[model samples]
Target: MEIFNNITIVSSEILQEFEKLSSSVVSDAMDILNLEHGGCLPHTIRPLHNYTKTLVGPITTVYAPEGTSLPVHLAMATHVQNRVLVIATDNYKSCAFLGDIQAHLAALNGCKGIVLDGFVRDKDGSQGLDLPIYCTGTYPKRPGKADLGGINIPITIGNIEIQSGDILIADTDGIVIIPQAYASTILETAKKKDASDAERLKRVKEFNYNFASNIHDFTSILTKDVAEYIKKHM
Candidate 1:
C-alpha cells in the first residue's frame, strides 16, 4: 500500500506561488523555452464542472489498470496534502476511474485537484466537493477495486511523462505538467509572461493599438502579389 518511493514533493511556498498562474500563461512560458511538448495533456481531458478557476499543485501520480480502482484507493491513502492526484489508466477509456466518494476523500486529505487520462463519473456528486476533477470523459460504468497499479511512479498521459512532485496547472484551457527539474525556472518565466500579458491587455484596451501591424515583414507578405508572380512564371 505504500507506493510513495522515489517521488519528490515540492515545497509549499513554490506551490502557493504557482497556484496564482493560469495554464495559458504557464504554457506560453514553456513555449518560449522551446519545450514543445511541455507536458500538455490532450484536449480530450476536460474539467468535470464549469469551474473557471485554476488548480495548481505538485502531482501525486497513479497508474491503474482499466476496470479497477484499487490503485486510486492506495493513492488516496498515500497522497500528500496540497498535491494534485494524477491518474493514468493505461489509456483505458471504458469505466469511470473515479467518482464522488474518491473526490471527497481526496479533498479531505487536502488534495488540490484530480486529473485522469481515463474517465470519471458522478458528475453531480463531484460538483459538490471542493476538488476540481479533470478527465477524458465520463461513463456510467464504475470500476472494480481489484487491480493495484503503480503509485508515485512515472506515468505517461497525453504523451507527457508525469512524475511525482511535478507541478500540474489546470484551468479552462486544459492541463499542463511542469517538470520538477524546470519548475522554478518555468515559474519565474511564467510570472513575467503574466505581467507582460496584463500590460499588453491594458495598453490594447486603452489605445486600441494593432500590435500586429508593427511587423513590417508580415504586412509585406500579406500584401505581396504572389498570384501575379506565379502566373507570369508559369
Candidate 2:
C-alpha cells in the first residue's frame, strides 16, 4: 500500500525533555491534560531484560496479524532507523512473533527499540543485541513468513491506539505513548510532575529515617496505659 512512503515524523526538542522523565511521571502528566488512556500501554508488556534502560524516540508502526511477520521485515528494511518499532499482532500469545535474529538486524540497522503486542523468543540469547525489546511474553515457536500486514498504519495494542508519528517513552516501569500533537503541553506538565515527585520523595525519606529511630508512638503509649489500668486486677 506504500503507506510509509510519505509519512511525516514530528521531531521536537520537547522529546528531548521527555527523555529525562520516567514513565510514571509522564503518565501522571498525561492525566493532568485528560489525554486518552493516560498514554499507558498494557502492563503485561515488559522488557526482555530486567535492567533495560529507558527508551525514548519517535515511532514507526506495524500491524502484523497473529502468526505473521512480513510487515516488520519490510519496515525494518528502510523505515526504522532512529525509531521505536511498535508491532501490533492481534494480541496473539501462543507463539513469539519476534526473535534474536530480527533483534540483531534491528540493532544493526540503527533501530532504537521494539514493542510487540504479542510475544518474542530468545530473550536469553538476545542479551547482547543492545536493542531493547518489550513484549507480552516469550515462547519457543517462530512466526509465519506470510506477508499479511501493513506498515506505518494505525494499530491498537492492548487498547492503546498508536500511529507512526507518536512519541514512545518506555522504561523499566512501562510504556507511555504521547501523541506528537500535544508534546509541548504534555512536557510542561511532565516537568512539573517530576519535580513534585522528587520533593515528595525527599520528604518521605526524611520521615522514614526519623520514624525508624523514634518508634515509641501513640499506640505504644496507649498500650502501656491500658496495662497499668489493668494492673490492679492482676
- Most accurate candidate by TM-score: 2
Best by lDDT: 2
Give the clashing pairs for model 1: none
TM-score of each: 0.83, 0.84
RMSD of each: 5.4, 7.7
Residues 1-234, candidate 1: write the lDDT tens digits: 337666576877877788899898888889887774456898998988888678888888888875788988877877747778888887797798878888888899888888887888888888867788988888989888875777888788877888788889898998899988898888899999899877766654565345454443233233235535544553
Clashing pairs in 2: none
Off by over 4 Å in 2: 208-234
Q: Whole-model lDDT for model 1 versus the true structure?
A: 0.80
Question: For each candidate, how many residue pairs have backbone atoms clashing (under 3 Å)?
Answer: 0, 0
Per-residue C-alpha lDDT of model 2 across residues 1-234, encoded as one tens digit per residue: 335664666656766788899999989899889988438999999888865568998899999885888888888888788888999899887778878888888889999899988888888778977798899989999888775878988889877899788899999889999988888888889999888778766655555444544334222333344546555344
Could you tell me the lDDT of residue 182 within candidate 2? 86
